[model samples]
Target: MTIYGSALIVFVLMALPLYGLLLTSFQPEAVIRSRDVQFLPATLYLDHFRSVLAPGHIVPIREGIWNSVVVSTLTAAVCLIVALPAAYALSRLRLPGKNLMLGAMVSVYFLPTTIFLIPMFVLFVSWGIDDTFFSLVLAYAGFILPFEVWILKTFIDRLPREVEDAARMDGCTHLQVMRHILLPLVRPGILAGFIFAFILSWTEFLTPLIFTSDIKISTVALGMFRSTIDIQVGQQAAAAVLTLLPVALLMIVFQRLITQVLMAGADR
Candidate 1:
């Protein structure tokens, strides 16, 4: 009973804000502006959602969404590519200063992003690549790569090496063994890494806002900032919901795998 009570309390605390946001998105503007708590409403007012999707907005929702998708997809893909090799090397080979390298990577990821902003911005400016999707993707990949590498390394370590040895004995090269065996086994870790990386890239606001100057090149997250002042509260709520919906759905689908990944990582 105590455990169930604690779970219920935690659920309510966690879910209250989300439930409120959902309710507010479907609420009348007057109710929102008036700051009245209408736990339930007689009818759903969808004008806010309509306004968010309506044509002729300063922040082009479609373009911003496409940009977010592109940045997030590219970030995850790049992280996966770079992390796979790095993780395999660390897991399988005895590399010099491996622990130092791991600590440095962790430190970089743990440090506040603001610490790198000004210097990275200047560096990008020098290269004339500031404010481009390529720049944004690269920035996000830098952050995601370390975390992905750690997750993949841990997972790879957990994998049975007997299979790889058998394949090697059967005349398979290391690359062939990895291609035909190891990757298929650690599919869950790869998927978890991708999903987490994609979500981080998708929801990133400050980095994109600081680096990007083009309105058309903005992400859905950055677009929210621009629209917040001009739009009604309900409309803002609707936009937030729209941006959050995909991520929420993705989490719901992979939640079990993610939980297992976390538990396994903890054990390792």
Candidate 2:
């Protein structure tokens, strides 16, 4: 009873903001701006949506969405490519100071994003890669790779070494063993890591804000709802609601996989 009650309370706390955001997105701008607090709209008004979705609107929402998809997909792919081999090594090989290396990697993941921002920006500038999709992908993948390594390593550790040993005894090369034997076994972890890396890249604001000027993704584009003169409350709410749709859809479809991955990590 206590657990159920606590869960319900937690759900409401998390959901209330979403409810308000959704509600405001549909309410007329006047109702939104008025002093009176409205929990429910007297009538649904969709000018907010029309305005935001319209071409030549203040925000380049359409372009932003496409850019976000490209950046996020590339980042996830890069992270996975690097993480698989790194995870395989950490799981299968014995090395001097392996534990220390793992600890250092995890510690790096915990460091605040701001710590890397200026340094990464300057480095990218030196390389003449700033303000490009490749730069964002590089930065995002670097940040996400450590977590991906840890997740894939957890999945790899759970597997039996005998399978690989048997494959080797049958004369399978290390690469072939990983491809034919281990890869199929660890698909869930790979997917989880990829999804998470994608999510992180999609929602990242500060890094993109600092790194790119002409190349704006959806999260940065959403900031167009404000200016020196006014804040378009209704349009901003509408944009916010739209910004979450992709992530919300992802959560709905992959909720179980995400839950399982998180539980596995926690249990480990």
**Top-TM-score structure, candidate number:** 1
The residue pairs that clash in candidate 1, if any, are none
| 158: Cα error in model 2, Å | 1.6
Give the Cα lDDT of each candidate. 0.85, 0.83
Candidate 1 weakest ten by summed lDDT: 55-64
TM-score of 2: 0.91
Per-residue alpha-carbon lDDT of candidate 1 for residues 48-93, written as tens digits (9 for 90 to 100): 8787877667645657778888899999999999999888888887
Scored against the true structure, residue 68 in model 1 reaches a CA lDDT of 88
Candidate 2 achieves a global lDDT of 0.83
Q: What is the lDDT of residue 211 in candidate 2?
A: 85
Q: Give residue 259's error in model 2 in angstroms.
A: 1.8
lDDT per residue for candidate 2 within 93-202, as digits (tens), equals 87788778778998899999999999999899999998888888988888888888888898899999999999899999989988999999999888988899988888
